[model samples]
Target: MTASGLPMPGGTGGERELLEQWLDLHRATLAAKCEGLSDEQLRRTSAPPSGLTLLGLVRHLADVERHWFRRMWRDEDSAPLYCTETDRALGFVVTEADTGAEALAVWRREVDRARKAAAERALDEVAVHPRRTDWQTSLRWMYLHMIGEYARHNGHADLLRERIDGATGF
Candidate 1:
């Protein structure tokens, strides 16, 4: 584990295990970035020009998890947690009513659902994309896509964290 108590990514493992570990590591890294922060701090923007915030990232990730795992993978009728057609980036639009605790809780629930959705599925198992009817995606691709999504957002989270406070590192 690192100083934040998150499990370290495994050095050696099977493909599935490695993917899951790396995904979890990135997820935990996002959570770790919000540690020791107040609700106001979580909502604080990284800079004036950018509206990115730790809370917004948490909410956006929750929707991403739901979209990929439940909506697409399981073909469930789960609506987005925050986003809508009018405001596609609604999840990243934190309002005065939004709180860090609630956002984190929702994100955690989505993560749990995502794990359950993929648990028994083989990597090569294919599913139709919910939005793109002509596109078929495999479980392996979903895992890889999710890892990249988290990695990219975690980079944003890192910048947001450093801007919020002096906190930096892994």
Candidate 2:
């Protein structure tokens, strides 16, 4: 558990295998981004003028997955995974308390919620989008979106991690 009290579940063999693969890859990529780094290192903004950090990416993607997979596509009445209309920039702003442990907890919790939402319906099941004026998406669509979003961010994470501590190649 790396002294974090979170068991790192090994292997991806639950629900859909391909879906599990995507989730595993993203999860590993996030870990890679913060690997060999201390809390302060993870929380430091990369660019002097910009407010972006490895920890923030973890926080942001957790909220992103929850917002799309849980809130919008699942039509969930649950609260947002993090942030709200009140704090739009919370994802990019890391505080002293935003440690690896806290970030991983949020990510895992949101992922669990997303999996529940995804499992409750078939791939063809549809939900009206909260933002689009005329849009409806299937469970499959949301799944694909979440996977694709994380994959894209994983690339960004690779670059950012390299800049942070000369670590690369995930």
Candidate 3:
């Protein structure tokens, strides 16, 4: 178990299993950052000039998971969850009305869908990049990219959580 009371991923596993386990660990880390915080607290910005918040990170990551796993990897024609053509920062702009529970649920659903999509294919399978149409990458690359993405954002989440109530840990 981690200091946050979430189960840490095992040190031993196959490549795919290990990657998934690490991803899950990061997911749980994000959730732990929000644990015991109120909806208002979850929506609280890190500072006056910044719009970043724990709830916003949850929403943004949900959209990111859907985009990468379902849309890009699976070639589904899904739209963005919180972002739009006009407003790309919607996910990072939480209001007082937004509930942390709903955002967490959506994030969990996206993570589950992403895992299912990844499980359906081999790590060597290639997918076309959504933006870079001429480029292709393997599922392994996608997993690594997602791991990096979560790691970077989780750092931000850590800071935000610390700012909220001084709770900090891996």
Candidate 4:
């Protein structure tokens, strides 16, 4: 594993193992992006007219994890942590009360719950869609979706981190 705890997915691992490893790598990569930054830096936006911050990304990802793993996968009745009924993008809008430590802690907790829920079901097991009951999804697809989600956001995080302190290539 590297500084981000990004372990290279082994070549001979099973499908589930490989997917989980990849997902974990991306998760760790995001965490690593937020490393060594102060609260102010974490809350700084990358460009003008954009409210996207490292802390906001962390909070948003937490909601994503909870939505997929806990609410959808486990069929739990859960509400949004940072989002509101009218503003679904509230997680991306950081307030003065929001702190990097708190957002990261929440994200870690959501990751733990996601892992636990995923372990309880096989990759092929179908979970009902949270909004549309007529639609169903498999655990495998969820893992893939999350991996992609992390990958996309990690790219944004990379840019944010770079702009914050001129740090690159974590």
Question: Which candidate's TM-score is highest?
Answer: 1
Over the stretch 10-125, how does candidate 3's per-residue lDDT look in tens digits? 78979998888888888888888888899999988887778899999999999989988998778998788898746768878787888999999999999999999999999999
Regions of candidate 4 where Cα sits further than 4 Å from its true position: 3-5
Top lDDT: which candidate number? 1
A best-first ranking of the candidates according to their lDDT comes to 1, 4, 3, 2
Sorted by TM-score (best first), the order is: 1, 4, 3, 2
Segments in model 1 whose C-alpha atoms lie over 4 Å from true places? none
List, residue by residue over 6-124, the lDDT tens digit for candidate 1. Answer: 87887898999999998999999999999889999999998888898999999999999999999877889998899984576889999889999999999999999999999969999
lDDT tens digits, residue span 76-168, model 4? 997889986568799999877789999999999999999999999999999888778998999999999999999999999999999999887
> Model-by-model lDDT, in order?
0.91, 0.73, 0.88, 0.90
Model 2 scores a TM of: 0.79
Better by TM-score, candidate 4 or 1: 1
Misplaced by over 4 Å in model 3 are 85-87
In model 2, where is the ten-residue run with the lowest total lDDT?
1-10
After the best TM-score superposition of candidate 4, give how far the Cα of residue 82 lies from its true spot, in angstroms.
Answer: 0.7
* Residue 115, model 1, lDDT: 98
Model 1 TM-score is: 0.96
Q: How many Å off is the CA of 56 in candidate 3?
A: 0.7
